[model samples]
Target: MSITFEKLSYTYQTGTPFEHHALQDISLTIADHSYTAIIGHTGSGKSTLLQHLNGLLKPTSGKLVVNGQMIDTKTKNKQLGDLRHEVGFVFQFPEAQLFEETVLKDISFGPKNLGKSETEALEIARQKAKLVNLPDDVLEKSPFELSGGQMRRVAIAGILAMQPNILVLDEPTAGLDPKGRIEMMEMFKQLYEKEKLTIILVTHNMNDVANYADNVIVLEQGRLLRQGVPTEIFSNPEWLNKHHLGLPQTTAFALKLQERGINLQELPLTEKKLAQKLAALLQREVK
Candidate 1:
């Protein structure tokens, strides 16, 4: 499934004293099975845009299409729920939403709500629990009894149980340690490749965009500032700096080396590539 936003604008509390414009004339297309990252600072429309993906918010003045459903002011509320089933939305700190007595029940909630039989839901629950690398024993335990990281996995399992074609993650790795964050991102990448799942990630972490996303969208003050591949967007240090953004650590390091008169042909986005380039330069100097 794909998504297209056409001159989309959203206003909260329209016609009220507290009206705030969240998005303004945003236009973009997200192709099926692609990994796209949305980047912006606080209050820059990232959160508002994510809500529009699953029909949680209606466009106030323009058209937005998801899969095949068109959304605008005229879109009926009843038709929106089906889109939620197709898009697995993992909000920031999703573990806080877990409330069922057992982890199995919590994971099974989405599928069961979608009208799956109890047996069917249980089967999916088990499968997704394994998919997220949760231990089989955890199913019988209370989700509240697990560690924070384990609780996170359980929340993710709930979304996977619905078998969404598109996984929209909003800061999915907010409060984890460095190791936990790396592992979580790797798991998402695996799912994107193995299941052909379309991933739309909203994050401030430039490293995530550099290492994973094929494309990036820049939102500034409720407007679309730029949209391009990471190399194109992050390569212009001046522009990123002007917008209060920075490149991934590897890319930034390469840029610094270039400024110091090193001859790195291109910026590297990952640690391994950066190490390899530095090693090759040293070897050539020795020879």
Candidate 2:
């Protein structure tokens, strides 16, 4: 489903001292079945903005419209619950939220909450486990007994079991090793393509944004800094550097080559493409 944030503004601890404005007149639209990444440094309101998407946090002022429903401060609890099911949020280190005695129970929690029978919930959990690449045997084990990465998959499976159309994740790959991070991102990409799920990822990893996100939203100090396709966003290394962000290594290298009169017709976002361009350049020089 599509999401629209119209002149949304939010504040923390309103009507008292220490009231801080988290978001300021933010406006954006996220199309259905599209993958978008929100990138920002700490305290830039990235997390706060994400919370508004699924109704976890209401805008102190303005509107949050998701799937054509307006989630204002007066949105009832029942309506908020429904919104939660429609937009599943996988918070940063979602694995920490797992609490059931067994993986099966944990993953089944969401479906069960939605009134699914035991058999149906278990079936849904199994299907979600497969989606997240969790093994069948892990279902019977205590969630806490599993490794950190396994717990992460199980937590994600729990969200998937709810069958939300829009999956919003906040720093989903944090704490994972390089290989694990890549695997996790690829799994999300596959899930998005196969299930036609709309994904909104909030992360600091420029490389992940380069590899997976169709569009990029850059935030600075609780305001929209930039929003555009990855190529358009990354093309301005100076702008990114000015915001204390950097382009993908491939893009940085291509910029360096461009500076030396090596005009690659297209910017590269992957190491393999950069290597191929460098090889062709060497061949031309040799000739």
Candidate 3:
């Protein structure tokens, strides 16, 4: 299902003295089955915007259409249940939210709550555990006994068991080591590719945004700043710097080369593309 924001805005503590506008007049569309990244510094409304994907936050003024439903201030909480079912949200450090006695029970909770029978929920949990790369041996163990990475996988599997069409990740790789981060990211990539699930990633990692996202959205102080593909967004290093944003490592390296008058035809976003570009430059010099 596609998502569209129509001049959407959100406010915290709407009427009181502390009322703050967390999002303001944002408008954008996230295509179905696409991997999109939302990036910005803290207080830029990235998290506020993400919550709207699953109806956790309703638009304060205008409307947003997601999963064929229009959400606004008037949208009732009861009506959001089905929307939440279609969009699984993985908050930052989701493993901290696990509470069931065993890994299997933890993963099976969502399905069971959705009315699946015990047998059906268990079957779904088993399948999702494997999907998230959790071992069968871990299923019977207490979730608290597993390593942090394993616990994270179990948490993700719980969301997968619900079978959401759109997976919303808010800094999902936070707190993971470098290797663990890569594995977790690759899992999301495969889910986006093989499962054809729409992935909405909210991250501060420019490299991941450049490497994984088909499109990027930039928010600034609760307002829409820019929206484009990674190339277009990263091409303007000066602009990014002006806004206190950093480029992908590859893109930053390419920018440095350009400063030294060794510019490529275009900046590369990933390491492999950087290698290819450099090799092509070498080949020309050899000729």
Candidate 4:
């Protein structure tokens, strides 16, 4: 499902002295089955823009259309509930939402809340658990007893059990080690390929964006600074740096090579691609 935002704007504490505009005339379109990363510094309105995608927050002005439904203050609560089912949101540190006594119960919560039978919910939970790499034995254990990474998988499984078409993650890899982070990202990539899921991840990791996201949206102080493919966004390091963002390490290395009189016209964002380009350059120079 696609989402379209048209001149959307939202203000916190509207009509009060503490009023703050979180998004200003934001307009963008997220196509179906695409992996999009929204990157920004803290308080740059990245989270605010995401909240509007599933009708979690109504736009104070302008329009938001998700899967062809226009979202506004007058939209019925029932419609909002439907939208939530289609767009599953996994909050930062999703493990904190694990409150049920057991992992099975915790992961089934979403489907159960939506009126699924006990047996059906459990089956769905099992499938989701497998999707998130949760072991069968973990189902019977208390969620609070699992490690931080395990808890995160259980929480994500909860959303997957709902079978949403669009997946939105807020800092999905916030506190994980390097290996854990790579595992999570690879899992998401597999899901996107297998299920044709539209994935939108909000993060500060430029490397993650470079490696995984097909499209990158950069936000700065409640405004969209740039939005494009990873190659387009990272190739111009200076432009990104001007907006308080940076290219991936590989892209930076390519930039440094250019600065040292190396004439690599195409910038490389991944280590594998960079290695190939560097090999070609060396071969050409030796001849």
Candidate 5:
């Protein structure tokens, strides 16, 4: 499913003394079935933008097109529930929201609530459990009994069980170790490949964007700063630095080498690309 925002501006507590404008004149079209990463510093309207994806928040003055539904000032909040079913949102720290007695029940909650039979829901849940790398043995255990990483998998399984065409993630790998973070991002990448899931991710992790995103949306203080492929975006280091945004760790290292007068062909986005470029440059020196 695609998302098109046209001059979309969201204001909180309009007309009140504490009123704040979280988004301003945001216009962008996120193509269907693409891995899009939204990156920005805190309070830059990143989370606010994510809320609008599945209609958790309505536009205060402008228009937003989600999937195909148009949301404007006159749009009713009730109409959003059905749209949410097609675009499943996995909130930041979604594991905290799990309160089901068993992991299977937790994963099946959405399908069951959507009118699926107990048998159907359980079958879907079991399939999703395997999708998230949760073994069958843990299906009967309480979600709280699982490790933090396993709990995260269960939480993601719940969203997958809903069979959404579009998946919206909010800082999904926030509190994981290096390995856990890589594994979780890889799992999402797999969904994008195998299920053709349209993934919209809101994250501060630049490396994840470099490694996994097909398109990158940069937000700054409630405004659209830039949007493009990660390579094109990272190529402009001066602009990113001016905005106080960061680069992937390897990309930054490559930049440091540039400062030391190392002449690699271009800035590489990932470690593998960086290594290949460095290896070619070294071979030239040997020659």
Candidate 6:
């Protein structure tokens, strides 16, 4: 399903004395089955925008159509139930939300809440748990008894059990080590490719953005700064630096090589590509 934001704006604590504008006249379309990344510094409304994907937060001024559901200030809470099921959100440290006595119960919670029979929900949870690589023995164990990373997998499995078409992730890998981070990202990539899930990820990691996202959205102080593919968005190191944003690791390294007079036709985003280009240059020089 596609999402279209039309002149969307949102305000926090809308009335009274402490109102703050979090989004302003944002217009964009997220294509079906695409991986899109939202990037910006803190307080840039990235989290605020994620809430609107499933009507958790209604637009204050304009309207957004998410999977055919129109959301505005006037849209009733009752109207959002189905949309909520279609757009599953995994907040930062999602493991903190786990509360059931057993991993099976926690993972089956969403499906059960959606009115699935206990047997059906448990079956769905079992499938999702395996999909996340959780061992069968983990199902009967308390989620709290598992390691932090395993707990996170159970939380994500809960969302997957709902079978959301659009999976929204907010800093999903915030506190993991380098190895853990890569594993988490690769799992999401598999879901995107194999399950055809449309993913919207909010993260500060430029490497993740370059490696995974097909498209990028830049938000600045609650306004749209730019929206484009990874190449277009990361093309201008100077522009990104001006906004106090960093480039992918390979892109940064390539810029340093350029300063030393290396002729790269274009900057490479991934480590493998950058290594191949440098290797080819060395082979030509030796010949």
On TM-score, the candidate that comes out on top is 3
lDDT of 5 by residue, 75-102 (tens): 8888887788888888878899899999
Cα-based RMSD of candidate 1: 1.3
Model 1 residue 25 CA deviation in Å:
0.6
The parts of candidate 2 lying over 4 Å away from their true place are 279-287
Q: Comparing candidate 1 with candidate 2, which one achieves the higher lDDT? A: 1
Taken over the whole model, the C-alpha lDDT of each candidate is: 0.93, 0.90, 0.93, 0.90, 0.92, 0.95
What TM-score would every model get versus the actual structure? 0.96, 0.94, 0.98, 0.96, 0.97, 0.97
How should the candidates be ordered by TM-score, best one leading?
3, 6, 5, 1, 4, 2
Scanning candidate 5 in windows of ten residues, the lowest lDDT window is 53-62
Please, what are the lDDT tens digits per residue for candidate 3 over residues 1-287?
68999999999998899999999999999999989999999999999999888787888899899879889889999998888889998998999999999999999999999999999999999999999999889999999999999999999999999999999999999999999999999999999998999999999999999889998999999999999999999988889999999999999998889889986979999999999999998999999
Candidate 5 runs further than 4 Å off? none
Candidate with maximal lDDT: 6
Per-candidate clashes come to: 0, 0, 0, 0, 0, 0
> For each candidate, C-alpha RMSD in Å?
1.3, 1.7, 0.9, 1.3, 1.1, 1.1
Q: For model 2, how does the per-residue alpha-carbon lDDT over 127-208 read when each residue is reduced to its tens digit?
A: 9999999988889999999999999999999999999999998999999999899899999999899999999999888888
Error of 3 at 243 (Å): 0.8
State the lDDT at 22 in candidate 6.
97
In angstroms, how far off is 200's CA in candidate 6?
0.4
Name the candidate, 4 or 5, with the larger TM-score value: 5
Q: Candidate 1: where are CA atoms >4 Å away?
A: none
> Given candidate 2, what's the lDDT at residue 55?
79
Q: How much is the lDDT of residue 149 in candidate 4?
A: 89
